[model samples]
Target: MNYAKEARDLDFAYKVRHALNESAENLPVATLDRLASARAIALSRKKQEAPAVALAFRGILAGNTGLSFQGPTSWLGKFGVVLPLLVLVMGLFGIYEYEQQQRINDLAEIDVAVLADELPPDAYLDTGFSAFLNKEEE
Candidate 1:
């Protein structure tokens, strides 16, 4: 009564049955019958141990349920996952907006020569600091 040998034989039979069933369309009738018998034996053994397996899965689910958030600890607790993400997103947006504003301001203060190279001379002809000051006086 070699337990290891018996286990090996059972495992081999299970593998053969699983393979045969997977390729049932191509399998011979005799081989299908043997595979079916092997599968039945394996299923019966599994059925006998089903309760223990079910209990094990139940224990796992119970443990996981406890680990999941019970409820908000306080009003702010609801923001635990959201608060950090919101802060990160807002910070990025703020930085982008600040950089854009800075670029616009820098472009506004660019030298006339640099502006002339980028824009037509006629566009800036009547737009100068003195004109701006005259407008302020008005």
Candidate 2:
């Protein structure tokens, strides 16, 4: 069935090509010249297509996968993916460092409070000290 369909398509294409060729020969020289000039102009204005990989990778930074990547701005597209990831990693590292510094500061404050207390450090080691403090709170 597929072979029959393909044969019919091929036959139709041949017929159409023959018809166009026959008609093209009968066209006026002036009309043909105009057509040739028009074809040249159209071809000149036509955009050159990039390779398959270039097309897929092009303008990806701008969320446009269809447009071709041009010369100087091509680097911008390539850097687009890496830039955001680099920034994210840097931001995360900064947040981690800030948290670590804050934790160290909190520990330092606790140490300073302990050292500045009026009670002797030995009193804190006593098992009864907690019980005495709880009783005093009552």
Measured by lDDT, the strongest candidate is 2
List, residue by residue over 22-72, the lDDT tens digit for candidate 2.
999999999999999999999999999985764454433555544446423
lDDT of each: 0.73, 0.84
lDDT per residue (tens digit) for residues 42-127 in model 1: 88877444444333443233343343443344334457767899999999999999999999888777764556585565655656
Off by over 4 Å in 2: 1-74
Give each model's clash number: 0, 0
Deviation (Å) of 20 in candidate 1 = 62
Off by over 4 Å in 1: 1-78, 111-138
- The local lDDT score (0 to 100) that residue 27 gets in candidate 2 is 100
The TM-score, computed over Cα atoms with residue i paired to residue i, of candidate 2 is 0.45
In candidate 2, which residue pairs get closer than 3 Å at backbone N, Cα or C atoms, i.e. clash? none
